[model samples]
Target: MRGQEMEHVLEAEGLGKRYGARWALRDCALRLPTGRIAALVGPNGSGKTTLLHLAVGLLRPDAGAVRVFGETPYENTTALADIGFVAQNTPVYRDFTADELVRMGGKVNRRWDATLARTRLAQAGIPPHTPAGKLSGGQRAQVALALALAKRPRLLLLDEPVASLDPLARREFLQSLMGSVAESGTTVLLSSHILADLERSCDFLVVLQAGQVHLTGAVEDIVAAHQQLVGPRHHGEPIDGVATVVRARHTDRQSTLVVRTDGPVTDPAWTVHELSLEDLILAYLAGSDTQSNHEAWGVAA
Candidate 1:
């Protein structure tokens, strides 16, 4: 599946990583199909960055495996050529101008698309000779993205590329990214803490919690399968053959639940409603199996 352009672009099974006795990622598994803009989300210590590093071959797994285009990417130049990564704070060579950076990329990557790089930067109004360090946060990020995209990578890995920008800058960065990917049909895996921004851009979801993947699927399927119910307060009971509660909370007179439903909710006692992508992501993250995560990561139960 990973070999074909129309199939899964990235695949991982039982992927894991560690720091001393702490497991940064544990038994992580997911498949990213081609041309999907997938969001990878989790709280601060849940291994989001670790997972991206592993996929891009910046770090090797301590156990299990990860494959990009069906090859282990650690030092695999051929596979690495097809993947591009932009890290947190949009790190770039501060001393290098956008033009210089493009030249550097052309020298290093065999498939570099210099025209695409120059065109994108020009459209974004980036000064060609300004050192990237002196450019605004948004411009520097745009330059980094252009460099990555100009390589014509099949899969792009972005790790919180807009986390530091102001709201307008953030929006512009995303718009530029979406525009380029749309034009090129590049598969994207983006990790960021801004859920609202993700909802607007990503169509697939990967939620991690306490160092393990808690959910993964197309965004629409996930939002549709999960429903919210509100009704008279009661012990959270399983709605057999109908819904499995993912999260629940109650007041004295009401119980509210988010459940994975099998069909139309027929129970007259409950009021069913749909969840937004942000709400659904929050529910799964809040309701994830932390006890198991504790065991997997060597934390006390």
Candidate 2:
């Protein structure tokens, strides 16, 4: 696992979890490649945490299986050792100090890197003696990062690690995390609502909507091929030459669309424009809504 090219440090197949009348995640299949940073983006209640919990084995799926390094992770200490997860909010023992947490990692984890933890803390300007409860949200986030890194896990899973930090702190934390990934070649899966941050730091992305994957691909490929099209009034002409229409808006005199393309543009009346990451994500989210509405109205003609 250490030397070989692991196709996926983590993988899921037909994964799902149900809570009576509702699903937190449904048939969620994921394949996270090694040595890359992936951001999981979704709206609130969109099963981001559910998918992560299943991936880390905090929660078991009812319908399918999750594999971390080709083995089930639920109670397998060996499998767990290769994975480090920081929950959506920062996790700290209120009475403990940063140094104490590092010591605990040394005691409990087989691959602890105490020196790295201390060095990271020093570099982040986090005081070793400060109690967990006394640190600000941002400093606490740094401590959490240090603790997770100290384990020296091959894969790091972060759930909204910077959700509570200030803007400046969030930027600093992401920069530090990016640096760690660059230095260690560690695979990272961080979930966030901030598309801008994800666009900057993640090489890959998973977009979730209504408990399912709306899209998954390399960030560059997704952005490079999708186009926004605006055209003069066309009453009923269908757009061609794109794999999918992610968004379309009409205002009587003109029509605009966001389409996923893989070939040269051919339509004469439409203006094709490259889409930003934000445009791509918003289009996907909007697509989910349109699909649901179509289903409700039985309008697929």
Clashing pairs in 2: none
| Candidate 1 C-alpha lDDT tens digits along 1-301 | 4246348888899999999999999999989999999999998889999999999999999989999888898888998999999988888899999999999999999999999999999999999998999999989989989988988999999999998889998999999999989988999999998999999999999999988998899998998898888888969566643567888888989988888988888878988888998998888888865687689999898
Over 4 Å off, model 1: 1-6, 288-301
lDDT of 2 by residue, 1-301 (tens): 3545277888888888898879889988888888889999998889999988887888878878888888888878888888888887889897899999889889988898899999999999988888999999999999999988888888899999999988899999999999997999999999999888888899988999989988887889888889998898655555677777777888888988888886867889899888889879988887765466688888892
- In the predicted model 1, the residue pairs found to clash are none
Error of 2 at 284 (Å): 0.9
Q: Looking at model 1, how many pairs of residues clash? A: 0
In candidate 1, where is summed lDDT lowest over 10 consecutive residues? 1-10
